[model samples]
Each structure stands twice: as C-alpha cells, then as structure tokens.
Target: MESSCPSTPRWNLDRPFLTGRFHQEIKGTSRFASDAKGCPLDSFSSGLENPIGCYDGAVQELIVIDDLLFALVGIEGRYISIKRVHGKADVFSFQVDASMDLALQEIAKRIFPLCESFLLIDEFVESGSQFKNGLVNHALAAALWALLLDYQAMVAQLEHQFRLRRLSIQGLWFCYQPMMGSMQALSTVIKKVSANNYAGSAVLNLLQSQAKAMAGDCAVRSLLEKMTHSASIAYLSILERVISWFILWI
Candidate 1:
C-alpha cells in the first residue's frame, strides 16, 4: 500500500524495455514475429499448424484480443466502453493480398489469455499489495492454472515420448517463457511492495510454493537445457527464476 522506495525507478511501460521481464518485447518478438527469412514455425509441419491442435483456434483468437487491448489500455473506465467503440475509427484491416496477416488472426488469438495482468513468481513480489489484491480479485481459482497447464503439457510430451511420437516439447514454450520472466519481476516487485510487513512474509511463502510447482530454479534450468540443448540459457535470468518459482507453485 505504502510506497517504500518510490524514488526507485521502475520500468517505463510507455516505451520499449531493454531488459527485465519485458526483454522479448524490447526485441520485438511477437507471436507473429518471424525468423531471419520469415518462417514462423507455426505454419511448419509441426503440430502448431493445426487450427484445432491444443486449442490452436482459441490461441489465435486471443492474439487478436491482445492487439485490441493495446487500443484499450490507459483509457479511463469512465466512458471507456464508449471510447473504445468510438476509437474504432483508427482501426484498419491490413488488406495485404500476399502472405500478410494470415498469421495475424492466430497470433492475436494466442495472446488473448495473457492480456490480463499475468503473475509470474516475481511480478507479485514487486508490488505486494497490488499483487495480493489481484490474487483476491481473481478469487484464487486460477492460482495454479499456469503451472497446471505446463504440467499437462509436460505430461503430454511424456505421453508422446512413450508412444514414440516425434512431438516437440517446445510446442508450448511460447506460453511459458515470458510467463516465467514476468513472475520473477513480480517477486522482486513484491519485496519492494511489502517493504516491512506480514505481507512480505506471506508473499515469500506463496513465492516459495510457486517455485516448488515450477520445479525450482535448478529443475527448470535442467528441463529447458535438455529440451533446447542450448548451453546458453538466456531466459534463465533472475526474472526467469522468479517465474520458474511461480510455475513450481502449487
């Protein structure tokens, strides 16, 4: 509730962020973002191409909603609905007859679920009261949703492994990587948010529990390392560890 170190500069969401949990945004990596030559693995022979695969259709719809969010952000709730409806003037459909917005629909749908305030293990730690408020606001029902989703995905992968199917574990990587980073930032935020109170202790307990669900920092790193086979775990930064803790949270 009280700002202990208000002077401590927080990230400015108005502009692009270079580091922190928003690193991917800084690099302009969107769901539709492509490789050097422009081939999103989405359309490849991978299972991602399926509109019905693992709720792929739903994911695309969410991506569209995410874009819609940027338009609605910072608008006051008072008359905001009218403002949004009126704000539709500037909206224009990209009429590219090429291979243009083909992926737009899908990407937009994918990011829809994440548009709301997402909690990583650390994002909450930064703003203790706000985080707790969000938790209470959401009714604590989806507390383990992210972790459960990952658990299910991992289980699916294990199933595929057992069936001798060549399914990629990274199919769901996009869903978790940023989630992990965001959670870490939240953890740091929680410490600052709580300052000196029982909120801090409660948050620590919650965070530790979340970390356990995420398989802790070591297990997370191990899993990612094994899957990507990358010696450099770029997403394993401090913010990422906070996220891992959250996913581990039960």
Candidate 2:
C-alpha cells in the first residue's frame, strides 16, 4: 500500500460541491426567468385576458367622423385640405373607409363642375375686352353669381349645424344627396354655354332647354326657369330699344 500511486479523490454524490452556487447562477440566467423579467409572458397573458376591451376602444376611437362633408364639397377644414394645380382643384389630407371615400369623391365630382363654371364665367366677365357690348353677358354673369351665393349660403348653414353637433355624417350625406341632380343639371348647362364661347342667347336658351328637360314638379326646374327669365331681361330690353329705333327710322 505504501508503494501504490497517490489515490484520486472521488466526488461525493450525497454532498455535491458548489451545489448552491450552481443553482443561484442557473436561476438568474434561466429562459423562464429572462422571459418573465422581459414582460413577454405578462403581455401575452394580458392580451389573452382582455382582447375584446382593446378592440372596443379602438372601434370607439375610429368612429368619430371629422370634416368628411366639407371635404366632399371642396371646402378646406380641420381634417381635410385642397390643392390647386394647373387650374384643377384636388382634395387631400384625410382618409376614411374605402366605400365612404368613393362616395365622397363622386359627390365632389358633381360639386366641382358648378364651381368651375362659376369661376369660368366670372373670369370671362372680368376680362372686359372679350365682349363689344356685354350687357347680356353681364346679366347672365350676375345671375350665376347670385345663384352661387345662394348655394354657398346653404352650405354655410349646414356647416354651422355640423359645427354645433346637430348633424351627423349620415344626416349630412342625406341632406346633400337631393342637391346632386340640380347641381349636375346646372353644371351641364353652364359647361355647354362656356364651351360655345357664350354666344348670344346661349345661356338663356340652354337654361330654358334644361328647365324643360327636368320634371315639371321639380324645384330645380322652377329655379332654372326663373334664372332664364331674369337673365333674358337685359336682352329683351336691348331688343326692344333696337325695334323702337328701327320703327322710328322707317
């Protein structure tokens, strides 16, 4: 036994060395401990526990419609704006559901033609050199100008109601829907006259034609008739003067 090599020390299974230290290190660095500290498990549990509440909050936030009606009519407002490029006014600065957006765009298409027609007539009149005797054209321009003012007043009233919280998006859309046909008809007549360079009697004749084409019971038909009569007054007066002079000469 004295000649034997030095004996190797054996690890004791019942009392392992540094067992507490190893456990402490593993506890600090374990995957479960890291995940808990990083809040991944807490977030997963919370999401599973109250997903419906989160969804409801999101829906509530999204349901508040803003500036949709004003934008449709090309008015600049809190949530929407307009940009003019190359004489074309374009709406931007807001977004909504696809179907709603499309509907607004369609309404805008009807509204803008009237606006453009008004501008075109205004510019034509203001140019001052385009007409030799512009009394009739001036009368037509004045009539269109008055009509535009009335339309704008109605829009302002609606905007006031909306601002006071008395009108909902659906209600506004319903209120505006009936005006589309009238606006389109007026735009058509104005565009036709404009395209023809507003020749003599063009505006009055087109207005009469459009009025006749409309339903007899229609309010816009009556309006067009009134405008035609008003616009023709100056032309009629001029014709009367010419006839009187011719009779005196004869």
Worst 10 residues of 2 by lDDT: 18-27
List the lowest-lDDT window of 10 residues for candidate 1.
75-84
lDDT for 233 in candidate 1 is 32
lDDT of 2 by residue, 88-154 (tens): 2211122222222334434434444444343344333333122432566667667766766776687
Name the TM-score of candidate 2.
0.56
Candidate 1 regions exceeding 4 Å error are 1-103, 118-198, 216-250
Go through the candidates in order and give each one's C-alpha lDDT: 0.33, 0.49
Residue 214 CA displacement from its true place in model 1, Å: 0.9
RMSD of each: 17.2, 31.7
| TM-scores for the candidates | 0.25, 0.56
Q: What lDDT tens digits, residue by residue, belong to model 1 across residues 135-214?
A: 32122223333443554465455445434533222333354445544434333433333453333234334444444555
Give the distance in Å from residue 42's predicted Cα in candidate 1 to where it truly belongs: 32
In candidate 2, stretches whose alpha carbon ends up further than 4 angstroms from where it belongs are 1-74, 77-133
